[model samples]
Target: MSRITLENIHKTFGKVKALDGVSIDVKDKEFFVLFGPAGAGKTTILNCIAGIAMPEEGVVKFDGEIINLVETAKRNVAMVFENYALYPQMTVYDNMASPLRSDLYRQNEDVIKERVYAAAKMMKMENLLERLPSQLSNGQKQRVAMGRALVRTPNVFLMDEPLAHLDAKLRNAMRTELKEMQANFGTTSIYVTHDFMEAMSLGDRIAIVNQGKIVQIGTPDDIYYLACNEFVAQLMGDPEINILSGLLRKNGDNYSFLSNGSEFVLPADAALMNKLAAYDGKSVDIGIRPQHVMYSFSKDAGYRDYQVYSYESIGNKSVIEAYPAGHSGRGDTHTHVRMIAPNGLTIKIDQLIYIDFKLDHTMFFDGSSKEFIGCYNEAGIRALSAGKEEA
Candidate 1:
């Protein structure tokens, strides 16, 4: 296992900067994921580590030893790219055996046969050994690429969306297999992907990158429950998070959030109250996940009437977006709120629904900077970020 570190790395391509002052420390045998949208420098970071793309500035180290000038072949890092870089002329077995047969990591036929069969079995591609790249599907080719990297006992594994081409069911299956393989091999790994579920499921820790800068580095729980900003929170969750512009107003001895002519009581968490004390009578953005917003056909106490803007199914569950009463939930409007609903729910656009936000789960951010301020469980999330486990 190896500990990889990048310090103040900066890379630019003539006019555009691909990475800007990025630094990360991946622990030994840890599965670290770099997650961001396309063109967000996720792949650039991987290339810097694999020696495929050298940063114009900063140091790259393995086990505390600087290796900025090391050649790719000498790094002993196995990389599986999303494009499935297999030799079209070679059969599946040959492609997987190519790494082991190379001069840097050459093995005899006896050992090669053992490793090839083991990798093929684990990837469930044993039946496709004799098939060439042209004879296999995209998903099959991706598996072969992953198997090729998996056969080697490299110092670290660098996987750049290895499962990107697979179908949904196959993608999920391969994700589980990859997780198990990482655990069994105990290899330090750096994975790059734009999929939130994949990053949360496979990574021991994840780094959120955006516009060439590292936004936040933390465990999945630290990220999901305590995102440092509105961008990170929206990127980490599906259906996106609801960011409502509002003012924290003092209500007698307590405080409440006022937004769009509606009011909701804030939780009595002492820490959260203390943080919001400064924001009282000023604008703030309260982030509430879809799961925290509830909707009912019938009016319930504390629920405000909203016009259903859209209701669409996303597999087993559906997302219902509602606009505050009288507003046209149309183009250029960003005031609608989204909530989760069961699939097959009988609903129609423009239907009136009553919804309420779960104030206890609300996350507050600065209105101007969009930076995180506090949340209901601020203490608990801070503990988790500090590497403490809850009892």
Candidate 2:
């Protein structure tokens, strides 16, 4: 396998900018992921790498040599699309064997059978080898599509939302199987998906794309706890992170944030206080995951009591939407604070409940620039740009 690199790539579709100066260095045999929302140019990147779509600017390289001019057939890369893209008239076995029978591979019948069956076995589709695509279930069809790619011994594997269309159960099963299969082959791969499940569970490192640009690249832990901006923080979680706006205050070395007239005294750290000093008396947004917020039936010593505005039952847990005790509301979407509680907990709308911030888990972002600035964690206060796990 070879290391893959894209340098400052640019591409356009008519008047639309599909990729704007995108660059990434995928290590040899690393399961790297391209993760972002729709229209983020994830597929365009895969096409460029496979020679299906060429960039108007920038270099594509295999190891240290440029492959910008290489033909698609010569690239030795296999791709599995979100659509199965299988032949309707061909049996499962025949479809799986098509690549081997192509001009470049040209494997004999016995070898084709050997490869196809092995792939079918890996996908647990050997029993359906004689059936056509229409005769099999949707999940079965998807497995065949994956089997087609698995039978090939390509230098790289490119997958674009391969499990996007499957039902939740099937998606979970396939996701687990795919991770195990990747481990077995140890093939260099670049997988693209909008789903965090795939990105977090599968990638050794994930590149989060947005509006045709690579915004941030890091391990799942880094991206979740040390997000670069408001966009990344909101995109990485389900039900979304709990975001609150407040006034920042600094009196000498003491620092605290005033949200809805109540003050939250943040632990002091010289370096972090220095960075936040600029925003004193100004409004900034703070974010913490719902799980990190704890609620008590009554007011605790240092915690504030809030009034529950709404609540929803979600499986074994409940999400409670609340506001500060005296708060009327703030205009725009940042009006309410959300908390998570156990399923059986007694709670209701308009009820007053006490809340506390696990400061060690809270994140602060600049209100205007929308970029992550610092956080209050177990290690006291630290800036996110420092990129070190709080000890």
Top candidate on TM-score is 1
The residue pairs in collision within model 1 are none
TM per candidate comes to 0.95, 0.90
Tens digits of per-residue lDDT for model 2, 34-147: 999999999999999999999999999988789999999999998998989999999999999999999998899999999999999888888999999999887888889989
Per-residue CA lDDT of model 1 for 1-391, tens digit only, reads: 7999999999999999999999999998888999999999999999999999999999999999998999999999999998999999999999999999999899999999999999898878899999999999888888899889888988899999888878788888888877777667678989999899999999889999999999999888889989999999999888999999988899876798888888887868888888888988989999999999988899999889999999999999999999987887787356899999999989989999999988899889998899999898888777776673221
Clashes of 1: 0
| Whole-structure CA lDDT of model 2 | 0.85
Candidate 2 TM-score versus the reference: 0.90
Per-residue lDDT of 271 in model 1: 82
